[model samples]
Target: MAEYEAKFTELSGFVPEFVNTEEKKARRFQLATKSFISRNFSNKLNLNVVPLREVLQVEIANREIIPVNQVHHRCKLKLEGKAFEVDLIPFVLGKFNMVIEMDWLSSNGVQIDCKKKKVRIRVQDGKEIMFKGQRKTHKFLTMFQTKNLLKKGNESYLAYVMDTKKEIPDIQDIPVVNEFEDVFPKDLPGFPPDREI
Candidate 1:
């Protein structure tokens, strides 16, 4: 209880507000993650798909094509399946993003604000250190909310991500996706050096 209050105070100094006690209780189980230059998203099994992967396969010719707007589904993050609550829409972020999310929607909308130039978190008497990786969640918003980095004094680390629902591959256009055959590639091209997990 005391620890959270101290961290909350530290977070409030960097941002305009702090999450309410009830909100925190409601969201305690949801895990938050972010992509950094050192580490980005890695669901590479998405890049290449093999033929006849679906063992119980059936093909239909000339079925009704559903536009991206009319579709929504579930998705799960391979790294943290227990924490992901997904909702898919046939609309892109910048263009059109169509996909499903996992069953849990509790954690998807939270945001973390870590653009502070030099922030500090103080705990007990005579214990304070430069704080890093400080962020908060605003339930249901996309990564857009996270991109709004901090700007203080003459220093700022604000960087906007691409509205990546741009022209996506035809494969992703699939109206429905299943985790059955989807796997991240063990070895991916253009991968950076290993970082601590």
Candidate 2:
């Protein structure tokens, strides 16, 4: 587990997420959690997501199958302090947030020290950024397998109280909209003349 801070324009900021590195994975493509994407990336304009025609099936630790059909291209990921552009497929990883395959690591000159629990990345400037791995701790909430529990005749329901008075950020303050100011004009013209395609 080579956890690090990842930044994304869609996310609108940096987030601490667990990144799993698998050397034996045959595929080179990386994966990001669907929950992570939905939770952080509320603005679609900043996301370069594409739906795949053919869904890919992946088996996790418990042999549960997860179908993947979306890919986020050229996503900006800031690991440690160095930035990187990567393609990530949306996945259902339970507790993990992302997966860093071996191909990407090898190509990017990333070295992992298992004994030291550190990940070293060599950047373009020949400088190395080191990320220390966090020790795994069992959290009661995270340990619950909802799907499995439900399969065993257990019941589950989402319970939440809505906060209707939550303050919404001003349109001008939105980073994504600000980036494309031309697209989202502060004031739209009265009307446009009807034109034929």
Candidate 3:
């Protein structure tokens, strides 16, 4: 393995200042969840198992930087009765960052809208599962399948995979607004059209 070194002829004082500011911005939020739950674990209802269905909608809360050697955006999640910590890591495809963006609606309420760019996390025997793209336009549909190559899983093969779109539909409906003709008198009579002097 070849080692490389960066040699700088001139070092600017502002370099440290700029780096400090960017670091602060990245580590703004911290995910905290253990404190909130006051219920006893012995109660069977409190330890209710969240149904690990093919797809589940979870409300995300407390958007904070997940400290994993480096700063990563993560959030507190609530799925049915269970509270979990989910890292906001997008599924990458080649050079594109096509992802399912999670947004916080209000007051620690984070919801995942699966209608656009669907994110499918298929569960197999409770532990093992695969994350897949459920939409046709998802760029990672093929890549996701290739990465998690399984002969047979609990999730149907045809359910998550989708065929690429053959052709883009032409723009059919476009909003057209008429120009205000009488806003200014159009070169009326002898008034030299309000010339900019």
* TM-scores of all candidate predictions against the true structure: 0.19, 0.47, 0.18
Off by over 4 Å in 2: 1-46, 136-197
Name the weakest run of 10 consecutive residues (lDDT summed) in model 2.
Answer: 27-36
Model 1's alpha-carbon lDDT is: 0.35
What overall lDDT goes with each candidate model? Answer: 0.35, 0.64, 0.34
Q: Summarize candidate 1's per-residue lDDT along 48-94 as a digit string, tens digits.
A: 21222122111112322222212122334332223332332222232
Q: Which stretches of candidate 3 lie over 4 Å from their true place?
A: 1-9, 20-126, 134-197
Clashes of each: 22, 0, 1
* Top candidate (TM-score): 2
The alpha-carbon root-mean-square deviation between model 2 and the true structure, to one decimal in Å, is 22.5
Give the Å shift of residue 71 in candidate 2. Answer: 0.4
Model 2, residue 142: displacement in angstroms? 12
**Model 1 per-residue lDDT at 29:** 24
Model 2 TM-score, 2 decimals? 0.47
Q: Which of 1 and 2 is the better model by TM-score?
A: 2
Ranking by TM-score: 2, 1, 3
lDDT of 3 by residue, 1-197 (tens): 12222222124343754333444544333212111121232132233323222332222323322222211233345434344454332211233422223332222343334555433332223432223356447455465675565543534455666567756333332223124334434355763566687
Candidate order (lDDT) = 2, 1, 3
Worst 10 residues of 1 by lDDT: 31-40
